[model samples]
Target: MTTTLPPTHRALVLDQIGQPLRVETRPRPQITPGTAILRVLTTGLLSYSREIYSGSRKYSLPTPSVPGNGAIGRIVAVGPDATTLQPGDLVFVDIYIRGRDDPTVAALSGVHDGHTVFSRRMMHSEWRDSTYAEYARFPLENCYALNEKRLLGSPSEGGLGYTVEDLLYLAVQLVPFGGLRAIGVDMCDRVIVSPATGAFGSTAVQVALAMGASVIAMGRNTETLEKVRGFFGAAYGEDRIQTVPITNNVEQEVAGLSRFGEADVFFDISPPEAAGSSHVKSAIMSLRHSGRACFMGGQREDLGIPTFYLMRRNLTVKGKWMYERGDVVKLIQMVEAGILKLGQEGGARTVGRFPLEKWQEALDVAAERAGPGERVVFNP
Candidate 1:
């Protein structure tokens, strides 16, 4: 079935760095082979959206682009090569797009311009337009269908009863899921998440708990740490989730973590401001023999790794970017199976919603509500 599409739609366009976003009428995206167009229901706003828009974050975004990373939407049309997806299907649009021929070349649609030369070229030449508009086009593989009936229908009518805004948590969950998967977190494994009060770190705790692993949430904020503990501890049992306040002193932090026993895995997703943080080292030192660690943080400074200690302990350390294609499918499955919850059940709440013209307000709210489980979205 094909739906009639308008020629133009309103979008929040970032004309260039350091300029205010403009809500302008733009031509609607046209579908091609291996691509699909979606009527975006909700696009999540990042907490640092203002920094990115103001050139403070230094993301290499192309000029005059619609900037949104991930969204939950309805499929409006599919390209000729498409087989399974159809019009009206509810799906989560993933922004991570890789070059078909050269998988190494990639770009985050509507977000980063790309780090490498090839990725930058791909971003500038194609995949630059993103989901922060009424309608957006995406690679066919990037659109994953959701269980529409179960997600949208009433619980009385055999549905999970989730709002479109609730599904926006998928975007927030994906990053931590990627890092956790990379470290091979398993059921019953004792895991430690450093700086677990932030958006991704807090979600890391959730994903870790959902995987049946016990989580030791470490962070500097006592209030937020307690909030995270209360949120998940209530569902998973207080004993299964533990919180440790990060003192930024390695010996003290390590001593605090040691009281919980050796952890099987240490997952760190610290932000740029957490450079040289003692939490990373403390968490690593707290791991058991043959333990694993995954770093998915934004710190630019080089970390001091205990080279001899890791060798002796047989510890495995790995770095992960966003996520793989298969990880997205698995994550959606986890959500559908009720193994991983969203919205109120998952401790997530949509704190604010804004229209395209109110992008600035949306960004501000997102920053203010930057803690775990707080969501701010655009109903574009």
Candidate 2:
């Protein structure tokens, strides 16, 4: 219960690493002890955020900093070790902080400084300011809550009318729903999402078809893989979605992912210009023997794993990062049980909407609509 207390706001600082993002005025974050205080409304504008603000991705981010990361707010204030959270609730901040006594010490607030020395002193001492700002604070377990009468109430009152820029596609669907829940994608599983079509592999082919799995989606962008198989094949169907193309030719991409069948999970996020892409060993040789793989991309080379065919196909590879606060509370309960649709029924579409002094035309329309459900927000 704390809302009337401004004492200064507006931000977007950055002041270092090739500088040029001022906007100033600060001073509004004041709730410490397991923090809380937000009001940020909508923030996501990543598309490589100009290679992490022009130092060309050296990214340790600890400048005069405010930058930005996951947001979508309205808590206003909550410290004293907040329990159920109050003062207007409508959360989802999670800039992946971690380190309340070493959760292997993490940090991503205002975007990464994490690479240990205790995650670069927890991103140069305690989550260095984020969410571009109009009031932010964070921590309190990375602030999750978000149902606000079924997302901004309406649908004749039963709500789900959604619109906080369609919850900014939960920051691009929480990094492929944390690598398809770290390769345990179940329900009718057959998964395969390779390069799927960028912007987090076309939202990991719509979060592996909203976790009910049945995708194949690979990529070399054959018309954005048939616009991601006609926008998630008209709501998860067209035989549960399939589209291959990445012909770097590992046996013609394992015979085009074995003409769609033996997968059972093989996610691969691939992107560091997909280093030596053979579509990640033809989706780990088209999965299936006890199958499973996850590899959340940004590919820093050397992923040539064929190691005796994953030890004779007992497969199961892992490597997930950036998720688990119960995967942002099960991705907002899979978007409030409507099974994951958000804005334009999940193929998203904001394309641009800045403020906070048009953050360089919102990072150039988030790098020219980064693709796959292109959204580019700010509204701070």
Best by TM-score: 1
The global Cα lDDT (0 to 1) of model 2 is: 0.82
Give the per-residue lDDT digits (tens) of candidate 2, residues 1-380.
57797799998898887777978886788887778888898888777797789877676778877879888888888988688987788888888888888786777888877777887777776577889878888788888888888877888988889888788788779888987886678788988887888788888888788788789888887998898888788888889988889878789878877987698888887767678888888888888888988888877768787877788989888898877777778888988877888888888878788888878888877987787888788888
> Which candidate number would show the highest lDDT if scored against the true structure?
1
Overall local distance difference test of candidate 1: 0.89
Under the 3 Å rule for N, CA and C atoms, how many clashes does model 2 have?
A: 0
Assess the local accuracy of residue 292 in candidate 1 as a C-alpha lDDT between 0 and 100. Answer: 98
Task: Return the TM-score for each candidate structure.
Answer: 0.98, 0.35
Worst 10 residues of 2 by lDDT: 119-128
